[model samples]
Target: MANYTDWNQALIDYFIKGTPHGTKIYLSVDEDVIERIGYHFGQSSTNVIWVNDFCIAVRIKVIFEGQVNLQHLKGRDSQGLPKGVAFLCATILAASQMAQEEKTSETNYFKRLREILALDGFARPLGMKFGNEAEEPLWREWNRWLMEDRFLPSAQRGGGAATYINYPISQSLLRRTDKDRLRKLFQEKQWQAEWDAQTLFAHVRREAGAFGIHLKDLLTENKQRHEAIVEALHQVYEQWKAQGCPTADKNNYCTWSRHLFCGLYRTEEPFLGQVDYYLYPKQQRGRSLESVEVKQGDNLHLLREERPGWYFPLEYSVSQKELDNGAKYQISSPNDLDYLILPARDFWILIPDAENPDSGAYASWQAPSLGTEFILLCKQELVSDIERLRDEHLLKSSCTPQPIFNNSGWVELQQCMVVSQAWDGVFIKNQALKDALQPSVKLLISFSGGLRVPKIGAWLVNHGPQITIFGFYSTAELKVTRLSDNQIILESSQSTNTSIRLDFSDPGHYLIEATFAGESSQRLVKIVDWDELAIEKYVHPEVMAINSEYHIFGSVIGQIF
Candidate 1:
């Protein structure tokens, strides 16, 4: 097997081009650079060789490792691993090259040659941005915070150059899963010591977010953007292996664009479900309510209430003919009687139209729907007290859900839950699970669990809803009511060959439930709001890959120098 030295030599040779030539080149790292490249790997390095004979600068790197520990370097000791060395080398090289080429900064490929030499391999760049140098203390503090839980004294002082932060090595850290091992290297304040409860909880939440990704959905989206990214990375690696670890001349090769990398981890162990609750943001936008004009310096004390139904005095025009017609009762300017007035705070989130099956719009509000009784009609004073309790983390252990208002005046109504791992397990639940075997509801089945197979069959509920299956993906499938009415079908995807019957409309809840021949019934359909569904479109493999690749290509040109 070729060693690291062989890989390193090839990388160096690719840049030098065997013949001596000076080229102007610039290099950048992480997301700190103005030009974006791809998903930020934990560690990376780049070399820009300037050849006077050619206008294009050669960008090269020996991508020792990738974002998800794919390279498996597993280096021992605290001198830093291959990733660290690569990161350092890339940083120093890019900086030095930029300093030398301060006068002429553009590096463009003219496409003078076809079938250019391929580079060994590529990984996403760390791609971090840097601000004013004055913020070293803050970087030191953040670094310290990352290393040690202890805060720096200077950090307490507050004002300084602001610095952005990213965790390139978070995946590696997660793999270890050992507190004592960390203590040997990092300080007590750093990540070395035993994980703190709060910090550990934060990590769990972040990982939970990643678990939410659906690969098949990602692939089918926007020309298979996500698939393109994975394929691009795979191609680079495969090419490198085929060349017997030859050096890569970045300038000579046709480069693939960079797409941000997403982390993926899998666990098949079933997770149980239990009743739990959480406080969630109700809405980000404030509602448009009656505008009460106040003198510039008016106390506006009553504004503190800010709740609906608070009487405010105002004067406005009314028809005198109506008054003469014996209609003397007062009509509020911003009429409240006709409105089932919600607080200006929560109105934006309360999509009163959620019940509309045809609107396609999803609710913006996010709150625990189970294990919490939401009493919207309770007294305002009591509600205020509940919100206050939730904000300070005082109600974290409470049995009842608490309410809170985020900075945006969003009403965050929260409920309580008994802590359990089950709540975080599944992506979506089937409301009509009990009747899953009856065949009325359509269930998309993939025997291998791969979901790639498009073969499908329908189940007919002789007395009830006729199940029609169409949509297929990695995690879930879509089923529609089979009928032949034009107005019945709303969404294009769910209406492939199937149609909805307007005459036999069934309300309440339905399911596109999935069940294997021998396995237990499970619901793969994720009923998300229109916005969350929109995310499905973006994260889809096709969309992410193409956009990311284009971004990466541009970033390389700008930073390769």
Candidate 2:
């Protein structure tokens, strides 16, 4: 019977010789480790069994097989057995008895516990090779617990002639030996190891010349410093102040600013914790960016950071013409300077003046509802347009030609629609719907965010060509029809997205009719030859002669808009 220490060393030696690489290998027992059973197999050591998530399975096979092999090698009534064969037999029998005592279920930890004890003396290595077919499930089993260590074991498995297969563990700089305790601790700290080497061989066969070697010999490295974070924030503030800050500023992304928020960390192998930390920040759940630094010349608009993602000065766009003197505007508030507070998540858009028919009103109007109100203000210069309003929706009825102290003027207050409101902001939409809204030019005629215009892929009328189409409507459904034959191409009831793919069996000249919110429009196109570069090249005799002599290839295929 081999002692615990001897068995432990024997298993490690077996792994070094029998298994493939030092990374992490499958189940195996060397002939040497088993042959030694005759010398010291019956002795017992004080050390208990330790098993990791993966090798626990491997160790189970080794323990069970060793037990069966020992039984077969020595008879029950043998007089002179191996040195510790009797002791080994007794230990295996004890484990079998313990395993039998435990109840069986879908997840029987007791059975596993017995197996773990049977092989605890030997080291069951943890760690895995990502970027491979085998190690995916092993590393992705996040619920299982793993022990931390000083050693960084790499399984090159380069699977090449030159790839080395040596597994080595380095000495620890700081030692820690703690027994298992309840409540797993979540240690969130930065690492200070060379990551360049790990990424160096990551998915081997990376262009060797492309990546130059990097060396970091730091006597002392400081990652998280309060002074550093504050300095980085101020630097961002100064940059924002320098630029004549615009209305919107989400395009700015500073690496130093982000680094200050999250300190540096390093790891040899790709760990889930590190990956999660890096990727979590990228999921912006809201309508806009996390936060923006806005400035406008000397008049810097200061905002109070009440919460993490609350936005002020809503980043709606406006043209220079709207702000010009003697120009008109339909604004949400009386003063353009009045800041807009918005929630972190919602659908938002800047409605152009041409699309909004309600902008025809003159005076400021307010609609109150649910302890809040939505306000709409018209520019003073828009009085001329308001004066022309004779429609009942624009001006109130039953007005008499009454004279007033203020002559040559008329004042008529019209009704405005009331929408909901919350702590973030108010919502408003007018009931005065336009009979014929303009077509969407800014809003694309795309096919699921792709291909704004049709392409002729077929060479002749008999060949088939694919055409993708999409359109969006604000107030009502968008109906797209083939105008040449009045065939309805596609219909999207409401909302933004409308996608469809069409395959023309017989190609020819065609026109599409698009009716959006009662407004009608058309797009004319033709499906022609796709083989030659250009129509001119095939038609012109001079160009064809040059092409036939040279036997050259070039693309003169201009895209249709």
What is the per-residue lDDT of model 1 for residues 428-448, given as tens digits with 9 covering 90 to 100? 122111111011112222211
Residue ranges of candidate 1 with Cα displaced over 4 Å = 1-145, 148-418, 424-561
Decoy 2 TM-score against native? 0.16
Clashes of each: 42, 10
Q: Tell how far residue 183 is off in model 2, in angstroms.
A: 78
Backbone clashes in model 2, listed as residue pairs: 1-40, 1-41, 1-42, 1-43, 1-84, 2-40, 2-41, 42-84, 49-120, 50-120
lDDT of 2 at 233: 23
Error of 2 at 20 (Å): 66
Stretches of candidate 2 above 4 Å error?
1-444, 447-498, 519-521, 530-561
- TM for every model, in the order presented, reads 0.17, 0.16
| lDDT, model 2, position 313 | 28
